[model samples]
Target: MASRRHGDYWQHVLDLVFLIGVTFKAIDGLGEILIGIPLLFITPAGVTNAVHHLTARELAEDPHDLIANLLVHGVNHLAGSDLRLLGIYFLVHGIVKAAIVIAIIIGAIRVYPWAIGALTALTIFQIVELALHPTISVALLTVLDIIIIALTWREWREHRSLRDTARETWRWLRPAPARS
Candidate 1:
């Protein structure tokens, strides 16, 4: 009985952790969409003004400002005709990320195995990207991903143990048929 209680406690903790992770991803996805929309529609002058104020550098000199340069160039070369198309592109990217977040949340709530697989794939992708980038920030993010993966695996194992215990208890409690 004590073991059963322990199992239940661990399962609850796992559920909480999964919930928190999904919530965080959803919030991050929403933020991406929100930020992307405004950036996509920024006029050439607006882009230059924004970048000048933010970084105070020529966009060509900074690879980090590539997105800003693209926006400014697109607006200048294509006029306002391209703005709507760019906006649509950003909106689609945002929607896809947001949809992934929603799927993760739903999968976690349902305790579906696919959720774990999805998270594992995401972690692997991040690690590979970090390796290729080889930057201090990316390295730190990779470390963070490792910790998250460990916690997620632990939670999954605890949930499995709790399910096994419950199944065993149910089997034991089943009444035997009367002998003829």
Candidate 2:
């Protein structure tokens, strides 16, 4: 009994955490859509000096911080369009994730199967993106998506079971038809 209650509690907690995560992505998407892509993008040539300077500072602060140093160098090496492309991805990804989050929150039973499909699509995209870029953050996000997929499947199963039980109970409680 205690384990059951604990499981229920953890399930709720996971749900809340997933919602918060997706909400942040939604906001991040909005940010990229509205401002990051439009205003902050710079050509590699335009930011060359700044990138070198920043990278140098990062290395000076902590010589062991290779990832930070590497990212600065990497962005400067990338084409200007890469930033814009990433921004576009974030914008679209954000919108889709938010819509799915809303559907899940509303307990739309039909949405579960569709949500799994949608998530699978997103995961594939993320994997492609990861292959292209290979950043730690991108890798972490892909892992998070996998976790959400599992949680969503669990929720979907529970929803179906609950509906089935309700139907059975209703049938048992309903009055029998009178003789013709």
Candidate 3:
């Protein structure tokens, strides 16, 4: 049916986003781990000094001052331990998200609940981060997560319905056994 095809089309699109998300998360995790670790060597004062220099240099060129200021502010606030902890969080979260996405892609119905739980947790975390840090990107990511949750729920229901229908049909189609 056309509706089934429509669902299939959306499913494929979501799967593609998952594939892309896996890559994005992997890159973001690496960025956090690699960049944040090195940044730990510097004290907050040192970060402040760097931000001052960064602002000076960025101002000399034609670039977005808002970006420079945001980066400076972020670096100014975080301590060494905070950076390391965030780095570790990103790496672990990335790995888990990728694994779940892959499982879902392979039609692992069992992972749907887990994926939903993990995504819900992540969305909550993002909301908290938005409260604390208040970035546009964080807000956008939250919105995207909400959309993904809806799509995932729809897909899960469709898959379950199809599975139940198949089982019922199989039972009905099977030949009746002879009575003893």
Q: Which candidate has the top score in TM-score?
A: 3
Q: Report the C-alpha lDDT of model 2 over 1-180, residue by residue, as the tens digit.
A: 011232354554655555555556556546645644542465666566666776787788898797767767676566667766765676676667767766755557678778778878988988998999787887998888788777667657666432333344344446778989
Clashing pairs in 1: none
**Winner on TM-score (1 vs 3):** 3
lDDT of 3 by residue, 1-180 (tens): 113342354445554554455445545545545555555465677777877786878866846688887777677677767766765666556656666666665667777778778888888988999999897888987887777666566656666432333344344446789899
- Candidate 2 regions exceeding 4 Å error are 1-36, 39-57, 131-133, 160-180
Give RMSD (Å) of candidate 1 vs. truth.
Answer: 12.2
1 or 3, greater by lDDT: 3
TM-score of 1: 0.44
Which lDDT tens digits does candidate 1 get at residues 1-180?
A: 223353465555544554455455566558757866886767757755665555545554775676665555544554454655656654664565467556444434344344456556656766786778656655774564455456545645555432343354444446667899
What is candidate 3's TM-score against the reference? 0.62
**Which residue segments of model 3 deviate by more than 4 Å?**
1-57, 160-180
Extract clashing residue pairs from model 2.
Answer: none
- Candidate lDDT scores, in order, read 0.55, 0.64, 0.64
Q: Cα RMSD to native, each candidate? A: 12.2, 11.0, 10.9
Off by over 4 Å in 1: 1-20, 37-48, 55-97, 100-112, 153-180
Candidate 1's clash total is 0
